[model samples]
Target chain A: MIAVLGLVVGVVAGLLVRPEVPAAVEPYLPIAVVAALDAVFGGLRAMLDGIFDDKVFVVSFLSNVVVAALIVFLGDKLGVGAQLSTGVVVVLGIRIFSNAAAIRRHVFRA
Target chain B: MSDHDRTNGHRFRAELPAEVTAPPSAAEETPGERTPAALTGRQRLVKGLWPPRVTRAQLIVALLLFGLGFGLAVQVASNSDGDSALRGARQEDLVRILDELDDRTQRLEDEKQGLEKQRGELENSSDQAEEARKQTVEKERQLGVLAGTVAAQGPGITMTVQDTKGRVEADMLLDAVQELRAAGAEAIQVNGVRVVAGTFLTDSGDTVSVDGNKINAPYRFKVIGKPQDLEPALNIPGGVVQTLEKELATVTVERSSKIVVDALRAAERPDYARSSSR
Candidate 1:
């Protein structure tokens, strides 16, 4: 309940302020956002499975964003930036879809 | 019970050592209460990849999700703003813009038509000027022939003065030439020399010279004119024929339908004389 309240407050604050992202972080923002979405879906799935852990959720959320950005940075140095980004997006997208499907099943019992 | 569980079980065994392996449900329990040594490698991997139910982690996750939602809204707003340049305009402004565009198109069309009409008029005037130039050139050629500046051929008379003893002086021949000119001789050639307005006759030893070109008898004159008028002008009493006969020169005047005076003289260009410019 406290988490949900914090989420609502954070969203309202973000929309009202409309903070500008720095140029250096701009490239990583989109991938970070995708990783964040994957984390959110995974968390929702864990919650429905009666396995939700605040420590695990926070760790995964932070690691997911950092690792995804790191992989893209390394790919850029290796001159395979675009291809690696696509690979990450595809993997994350599949995880998101599966997690969402699991959450739907747990909620609707269909 | 399902193939999914069996596959997960195999993955767990392959990734985690037997001693570090624990029940998967350990992730749902209090994360702080469990010892790190009791947690399995597979459970640790799951904890790293998924969110836990702890208050602090959940709050952080929710905050991140809120940011994601805000970013999406911003992206949507910016995108729509880019395409909404004219969308914010009033109905009257849009109508006025359309009317202005129509007026511009109509003006351009009218300008094009006017230019086309001007081009047509210019073409017609140029064609008329070209025709006039051709006619002027033809008139100049005719005038050149009449002036004895060009060769001429037509029906006329050929007079031969047989002066065997060379009694015919240049003055008497000059008189005959003058008479032919008065009788409307279009072109005249005397002793192969073209007789123009500037021609002079002079006696040279035993022969007569026309324009400094000496000729031997019998002196032949090819005259381009009306044959009837030319023959009569020579045969009239006290004319060229009588004067030549009295000089003991046998003069024969023949009327032919075609006489060619193939002699040319350069037309003089007057430096000071010009046509009056109206």
Candidate 2:
């Protein structure tokens, strides 16, 4: 019961802590979407007993979202606002692969 | 070691039945049993950025990581916001500069139009002067032809007047020329030079001059008028000679017959009008 409570609260708070976006941030909204997917996948993996590699899930989800947002923000500053989204997707994809492996490990344990 | 490990939880669970393998329902638990407390959401988030474990060392590491990540997020957000504001300022500056350039270009176009108009006016005046020069050349050519044709004609009239007596003035010569022209002269000359509408006179050395050529006593002026009307008009009582001789008291007049003047010849000109007529 306690473990389940911790998971529910962690997931909910993660969802709610979304920082305010700016108009200059509009081009980066797609990166935000990828970050959202990373969190959703992490939560779903948790629910399904897909992988309980807590470290993997937290680091992957955090770095994917945060680094993606940072790259997009940096690209906007560098005047190549469109290309930052590519970096966002790339980092998100890397994090996704790492977490997916963890998911597979526990879920497909032979 | 055996004495300290005697009351452990593992030893207690080992004493329970196989029913313990199944999830423990509320009905299976003894009433008022103590349950483990759940960690708060803030505690879970603080620990999330760290290694997955629970110990004094791990907790300390988790707290450090949480501080680092939190500080990084706040700093990045603040700095990026400032950068965004600066970008907006640059865009505004660019737009303003473009507008100024547009305004300058518009003014330059207007100035160019005004200069073009002035240039057109100058060109028009130049073209007029060129046309006048061409007409003067044509007239000079016609006069050359006239001189050739009229060389054979003979017998003309002559009149003379002067300010040598210190009384006649430049107007006296102009008056004489006017009267000769009115008397139906075909051609006239003053001081051995052809006199036309462009003739001018000025005073020099106590005598009035014609076309800058001087004359002495009995200044010889010639005219080719029809003899009958030519002599009668001037010799009529109280006429031009009477008037001029009365004033200068040194003027003279003379007339003759068989005066000759000629027609100016012209070379053929291309009739572009015919080809362009239609």
Candidate 3:
């Protein structure tokens, strides 16, 4: 319940603040968002499965965002930023889908 | 005795009924009551998953999800805002804008290629000084034509304004000159006076003066340029022709294979200006 509340608060704050993202960080935001989503879905699945661990979820979320941003930053330095970003998004998108499927099975029992 | 007793104890427990030995409440409360080895893979997975384990973990996960949702919404909002202008534009307008951009790019590319060709010629010429001198002479001739110091001939339109009522003013004639220039007239002559870059028209009594040279009606203009462009420019609705005709003047535009602008201006040397190039 607190977790859901925290999520709601975060969304409300973001909407209300509407802070301008720094230009340097702007390119990595979308990839970071995708990585965050992957972590969220994974956490939700773990929660449903009763194996939800706070330490594990926090670490995964942090590491996912950091690693995803790092990969994009590295790709930029290597002059393959666009291609690498696409790859990151694709991989994260697949993970999100599978996690969603698992959630669906847990909730709907179908 | 000890071995026999222990064997009998095991046999006694095995022989006992399941209901008496294992209670349902105990099984429900402590999942550890059954050995882990007795549980299948699926059963173990289910056992690990059920019964809402930790509150703190849920809170943290929710917080992370909240952040993700916020970022997603902001991204969506920004994208929509950026796209709204182009999204609302008419297809024809969009296509025209795109075409204009393409035309500008093509023009720039052509200019770049021309410059590159000039540089290549300068580099490849065996007699570089001679080549440069030749180019300078060619450039001077082109400048002379523009300055109205040399006569020019081209395929263009001849506009004759026969003003019987004398309603045409100097300013009206000036307007006509401006319109022709906009339509890409390379060289223009009013009567026998050359219309140079600094040519000015003023009312001198009943006649209009072109650069202090009085030209009386019928004022004949020998314009050197593309006939198709020059003719339409004069004949456009409410253009020079219609404006002149409204004032009781007969404006006739004749397209010719060749129109000669023979009136020339003396090349005046500038006393104050000098070539800044090395």
| Candidate 1 clashing pairs, residues 3+ apart or interchain | A52-B53, A53-B52, A53-B53, A54-B52, A54-B53, A54-B54, A56-B52, A57-B51, A57-B52
The interface root mean square deviation of candidate 1 comes to 10.1
Model 1: residue B109 alpha-carbon error in angstroms: 4.1
lDDT by residue (tens digit), candidate 2, B218-253: 566767766667777677777777777788565556
Off by over 4 Å in 2: A1-110, B1-152, B162-164, B248-252, B259-278
- DockQ of every candidate: 0.11, 0.06, 0.15
Q: Worst lDDT window (10 residues) for model 3 chain B?
A: B1-10
Better of 2 and 3 by lDDT: 3
lDDT of 1 by residue, B25-120 (tens): 355356666654455444444554456455556556667667666655544343356665554333456778889999999999999999999999
Candidate 2 clashing pairs, residues 3+ apart or interchain = B154-B258, B155-B258, B155-B259
Q: To one decimal place, how large is model 2's interface RMSD in Å?
A: 14.6
RMSD of 3: 25.8
Best prediction by TM-score: 1
Which candidate's lDDT is highest? 3
The sequence of per-residue lDDT tens digits that candidate 2 reaches over residues A1-110 is 23333444444443445355455655454566567455545543342331224454445556656766788787768876556566667766775665455344433421
Write down the lDDT of every candidate, Cα atoms only. Answer: 0.74, 0.54, 0.76
- Model 1 residue A59 CA deviation (Å) reads 38
Worst 10 residues of 2 chain B by lDDT: B1-10
